[model samples]
Target: MHLERLVFILEVVGQKGRATVADICAQSDLPKPTAYRLVQDLVSSGLLESPARGSFAIGKRLRRITLSDYSDPALLEVIAPVLANAASAYGAAFFLSRLRGHWVEILHVATPETGVSYLHPGIGKRPLHACSCAKAIAAVSPELLSRDELKGQLRQYTEHTITNREDLAAELEAIRAKGYAECVEELERGISSVATTLTKTGAGSTVSIGATASVRVFTPATRNKIGKALSEMSQELSCALGWNDADAERICA
Candidate 1:
């Protein structure tokens, strides 16, 4: 198919970082003339750049589009496989969420069909004080709460919700020190979760990944295990996003 060939050419160029007509043809198994034409078209359209007479690399337009997607927090291409693995390995409902203003929006969720209860956090605005995903974001950037004046405005969803600013600040400090957040019956009764911040931004807003389960099912051992898993996965995701361990520590600190 034409679309398939176009995608193939792009993939080859992307993987190689820079490719020539010969390289593109070899990688895509296309005729030299066809590869040349496609590469020329891409270069003309600003999706690929010709640095020299024959070599091509990703263009400014493509990088700009990728940056736009990252800013929009719709980078599911990178997040999906990690979430799937976490859900399968942990036997819990894993979710990816982004912070927008004062709310943490559930962008994606992955859970097993038969083994786990449907732990969809539902796609919408969520509070920052009571859930692990939001808490993870808060732990990384406490200034969001301060800037939005949400510290004193937190609502008590359940008896365990952190209602006061002082207590919530202490909780965030603990989460920052531990590199993750855990919630037990805070947002809803009998539900518990552990979460870690996945992506750090200069804007002081963070994205997080987390897993949720019933309190009855999450023992201390399970909680510790899931917490470790989330933290490790978060570090991996952060690295993929170009944040090294030192960058992550400084940003989170």
Candidate 2:
């Protein structure tokens, strides 16, 4: 009843990017007046915000709660230093990505001192097929990319981007076999990334640890080194997150 309506309203606002009371009512069977009242209540409670005069969006409080539940601060403390060390060592940018609802987004970043012309992609939803971070998780958790919304609809950011569904399917399979994913100028020209999925826990949050650099810098050996590093860090973090080897095999394998 009320609970369902609130969840539905949140979903509508989330999916629409910004949803108005009228927009929400139109999507659900709730009456216009009831929707308006509920929307106001949500805004008052800090779960939603009126970004525009009439449109509503996710609020600061909700985002905070989501982040806390999905990414523990203690774990992130360990992750941050790992990214900094990796970035410094490789002379590249190291990033941590996490699931936001159903979307995997860049959560944090550490960049090397010398790079101004590299690591252009910023914090936002990552392409499931083209991004090594997203692919790493999607390889283990296939349900995330198998949704109807993404089937055969992967956007091509560069010539190397895999747009074909069949090709992308094979790519995911390879990622599983390798235990890491590498993007060779797929998301952008000259920029490439290598990522591996974090070990899973019962909390249901999916994350990836990755490193990005200029194509010229990653060369063959450097790429392998970063890939190995990401894999090992991902494993350590996975253990700290509390799932055991048997559980990982059951859930991932």
Candidate 3:
């Protein structure tokens, strides 16, 4: 039964957009009778959806699996204004992201007011080892750096990107102690960014806020100021999410 269920799931997702039961059966190398039965079961269980007469696709339940916690209205409301304020204050782009699986997915972004530079909309996937926001979260969430998962071969996004695992480990430790991370044209040639992670209640998923500027405008002093602001905002959000005083102090200090 488990094998049949797994085959059904694989067939459905492998279809990418949609597929008919017959298509799934053909892909799974399963008998038509068994495929029909499993497909019916999956559809009834909300694991698959039929948008058209015969076409089946991933269901709302499967979609919700990727965005489970982001549905929190309280978390959204609290973080949105903070990102917006940072974008306005610094005249730079701001992003709110959360570690999702092996990647950091940007959930929100605020564009600069002056509209001088093109805005890189922050809604997408970023590599955990390379992005400022992802690195900030990974610094505190050891689960992200589990030796069993991504043991070696960190990819370099740019010339300044950290590719050595030991060096990256040390850098992440420093970020944990300082409560923030910075990238100076590391991910992209001309972009500079700073980020801070917020993990409340010790068990919930970690979130991060990132602000980006053109390298020309991101001097050391400005990066320091932005890092300070991001650290404070991260602490405030962490407090809202019920982090203890010690955790808050460690993050803010």
By TM-score, the best candidate is 2
Instruction: Sort by TM-score, best first.
Output: 2, 3, 1
Query: How do all models score by TM-score?
Result: 0.67, 0.68, 0.68
Candidate order by lDDT, decreasing, is 2, 1, 3
Model 1 TM-score is: 0.67
lDDT of 2 by residue, 1-253 (tens): 7997898788667645677888787666789999999999999999999888998988899988875323235456767887887777767788988654445778688887765545645777787888899888888787766677675558899999999878888998998887789999898888888998776434323678898888888887888888888877776666655544654555443
* Pairs in steric clash, model 2: none
Q: Global CA lDDT of candidate 2, please?
A: 0.76
Q: Per-residue lDDT for 1-253 in model 3, tens only?
A: 6775655454344323566767655444568887777878878978778898887777788667744233334456778887787787778889988654456768788876766663464577777778788888888876667745476647788998888877888999888777788888777898888888765335233678888887788788888898899878877877666643565756545
True-vs-predicted CA distance for residue 144, candidate 3, Å? 1.8
lDDT of 1 by residue, 1-253 (tens): 7877776676556645677888766544579988888888888889889888888877889888866335333356777788887777767789887765456767788886557554655665567888888988988788877864574568988999999888989999998888788999998898888888774444223678888888887776888888888877876777666544555666445
Q: Which residue runs does candidate 1 get wrong by more than 4 Å?
A: 1-68, 71-74, 113-118, 199-205, 245-253
Count clashing residue pairs in model 3. Answer: 0
Worst 10 residues of 3 by lDDT: 66-75
Q: Rate the local accuracy (lDDT) of all candidates.
A: 0.75, 0.76, 0.71
**Alpha carbon deviation, residue 135, candidate 3 (Å):** 0.5
lDDT of 3: 0.71
Among these predicted structures, which one has the highest lDDT?
2
